[model samples]
Target chain A: MTAKATAPTPAPSHRGDAEWLSMRERGTVLGIRAAYWLAIAVGRSAMRPLVALVAMWYALFDRKVVRASRAWLLRVHGRPAGFWQVYRHLRTFAQVTLDKVYLLTDHTRALRFTRTGHELLAAQFASGQGAILLGAHLGSYEAMRAGGETTDLPIEILGYFANSRMINSLLARLSPRAAAKVIHLGDDPIGVMTRVQDSLAAGRFIATMGDRTGLTDRIVRAPFFGQEASFPAGPFLLASVLRCPVYLVLGLYRAPDCYDLHCERFAERIELPRQDRAARLQQWVRRYAERVEHHARSAPDNWFNFFDFWAAPPAAPPSPPPP
Target chain B: MSQTDATLEDQLKRLIVDTLALEDVAPESIDTNAPLFGEGLGLDSIDALEIALAIHARFGVRTVANDEKNREYYHSIKSLADFVRARQGEAQASAAPA
Candidate 1:
């Protein structure tokens, strides 16, 4: 047999595609706007079939999403993923996205939440100091926000929202109060830092994603799912600078209507001294990756990063070696 | 500028240079009025955090997180010196007896 015939099919090269930031937000504004209004008008029970239809459309037509989903599923399951599995993955994402409408609108009476390690957060609040809640893209952060509202805990989301302008704008319209809670990462560095600091100092938790690396963010490589992937060092660096406690919080979707909000302390404080800064950063990132892996393995379908997460990062000039 | 303010600015310039590890850029080379971020020294977010930490550790004067004036205060070396001096004055006043 020819060498080519004997070889496994090479995965399509996504190197040409810029990072997730550059990926177009997929659906048309009008379509998403229409969907949002429809969900609000008809309510979730009536919207389930339509959501499934839309998810099915994406699962069938979006080749990139399908490939990414299959890749993640294979790693999680240790077997080839079936077409139905991919469809269900897309459907789950669609359901969660749709739920954001109700969550943002304070219509969370229909949804259920089970919280664990809440006492840890309570103890942190008892200290009269703010802490950082590091979350991932695995599940519904909105659910956690809703839970916080009921308990009178203020949470500010620090995120880069340039990519999802349409969705963000629509969601903001859903609840101006909820919109105010978002601290968009933008041009004003001092403003962003000060806002985060102020919130933390006031004993309000600041929630941010630990996974996605921004365009100019410093990143560290960590072994994830038996492969090396880049995780942003920004969160950890910010934690060290702010001199605040860091906690891992994930709001996992347990299908149908329940969200399990899990919170655990990641660090009392992240200290990266000048003597061993890189190594310390690497250790924190590795532990972060391990925690993310542990959770992702348990809730395999909750993984929402619909991109080639393991693809080689864009090259950058190497830093000068440590003295 | 007052002699103390000038000295404070110079001290801040050295702190920025050393804290960020600007290899070729000398402390004195940093202009007092030149912006510290975005097009001036060409620093990013991480650099800002480093400078914040260094200032906190070295001067023991913490930058107030919610102060609306932080943007202006961090604009340049001169402004940072002003901020530090003002905060120092406030701390001293708060400590003094009525």
Candidate 2:
């Protein structure tokens, strides 16, 4: 007999009302998988609407998610940009999010644009050089997956996986070629780092999140976008341990289907100096900030860090209790 | 099912409370008749799998997914305890060789 499909029981009062929402999330996950198979089996047109719907939903929603997102933008940026500025960035973020689906489904030449920063990636990977590909939450930065597809290079990503195994299995089956290359170390901190170190030792590329904290407190404080916030130390520490060249590889979504795969040489060969490791990390952190800063300043909304950011003082103690 | 075994029941309740990270839940508050995953302790699919794994490793009792009776037995701590008791008794009976 097949394993019983036991779904999570959401909170009670809204149990009857919430079934639709729970189904929606499941649908969203399935849609993503279906889009993948559609891309491979039925080809490109099958995925166009899937990508479009993702972008439109984020762009059109004004109150619930968008309103909260706008508040998040204010808190992170310290001030609001013009209407067009916010809209442009949100549109870019949405488009890039969709762009990932399109990239996964389509072939290489199906991509429209120059391979702008690929040489930088190769140069960093040459010899015993293994660097962290520090990426922002902005754009559909799945270009690295595409890169592994195009080149014989072994690129492994240290990232979060969906909670659903069904989805994971489908994704692996969908893109068997690139799926083997992508190393998604979801919750295992020690194991994740070990895999990164192992992959690098084998002269393979390991890419992880430049921003965001893991479940526990694997976060470190840093100043970004003009405020004190934390970015995961996994990227920097992994770079230090492996002693590899580090590049900030980002794929910016320019339009509906098209994207600009930009790879800039942020830093090559960073030294921990044997004594002051934190200082060495700060130097690399500054370089990561500079690289992201370059793009974020140009396309402010394209920086899709959904949670609160730089506005808060680093580890500013929790606010006083309300009377 | 009414064993009047308060200590053993409390120990199991504590395990449920701690393992699942049931934030607002109290051990005494969890009703024996209420569902542990859904209506009672409020756990999810991943948590259910985790709890199932925890039960197998801790108790040395491997739960059979194929068993139709597991639907009623896996529903609550009391039900689960009874199933375990029955299984253990069967083991003892077989070991004694008639």
Candidate 3:
């Protein structure tokens, strides 16, 4: 056989494309979302069949792409779910579009819930010292609206919201609930971080993702699920740099309108004791990775990292040493 | 400065080992003239940037973007040695008790 070439994978030249999957050319998805929001605005159940028909058509005619996509998810991620199961998940992805539109239109009713973690949240809020709520994409985290409404402190979600301007504007209009507490940390991160710090200083309760890599330069490599992955050191770095406490909290979906509010101590206070800020930040990343792995492993079906976690080549044999 | 240069390769090896936490890498085994980007060490762009930052903090060397000097400087232990020698010369000249 001819010798194979070792070249870097063909990727977008922009560093931001390396950051994460781009939403720029996602006009089809945007169009679907726009149609949903328009239906919601018309205040008629008239478009109900139209929306279901679109979902049905995708499930029926989009067989090739969905099969390949499902196969990849199964092959790469051990998704034991069958073709129909994967189709259901994709079908529900459209349902989430409805959620986004509903959130913008009727934020309170959509995000409304009965609180359970009262004493725990209250003490955290009462402390006047900000706490980090480590949440993942398990449940309708918008239920956090009820969480904030119950507590004395402001429960602000520090997340990288949708980049699509049209979708975001729709989300703001369609879901008044999400618009109230949702703060978008778009491309310019340090500026958004200044706001996060200000919120924390005001003794507000903060919730941010501890799973995926963040939008900043700071990163820490750690082992996750028997493979190496890079975790964002920004949150931990901020905790260390800002001398704050970090809590591991997750809102996992149980059923319709019900969720399990899980909480555990990842690392309480990450203030730099004697070492440099970077070292302390590394410590926080280590704990965060362990917690993320533990939680994801606990619910592998719920592990949401669809992209390659390790980013290593598939089926490559270890080569012999170079001369 | 030769004393520092004597241990320079060892320092760089230590830097990579420490920054990446690679299980199999040893300082003495890293080829002096091997390519760090591709076949030699099999390092990626992220690793290059990661090791670059750590090396800068430790050795006072700044890695510029899209720079060709890196290909030459990162060629082998000998190339890094020569570059460090020039930097050390400048540092010494600037610090000659002026």
Best by TM-score: 1
> Among all windows of ten consecutive residues in candidate 3 chain A, which has the lowest summed lDDT?
A1-10
Give the C-alpha interface root-mean-square deviation per candidate.
6.4, 14.0, 10.1
TM-score of chain A of 3: 0.65
Candidate 1: the clashing residue pairs are none
Report the lDDT tens digits of candidate 3 across residue range A227-257: 6666665566556545567777754433233
DockQ of 3: 0.04
Better of 1 and 3 by TM-score: 1
Off by over 4 Å in 1: A1-19, A22-36, A148-151, A163-173, A176-180, A317-323, B1-6, B21-42, B53-98
TM-score of each: 0.80, 0.59, 0.54
Pairs clashing within candidate 3: A103-A175, A104-A174, A104-A175, A104-A176, A105-A174, A105-A175, A107-A177, B32-B76, B32-B77
For lDDT, the strongest prediction is 1
Candidate 1 local Cα displacement, residue A21, angstroms: 3.8
Q: Give the TM-score of candidate 1.
A: 0.80
Local error of candidate 2 at B10, Å? Answer: 42
* DockQ for all candidate structures vs. native: 0.25, 0.02, 0.04
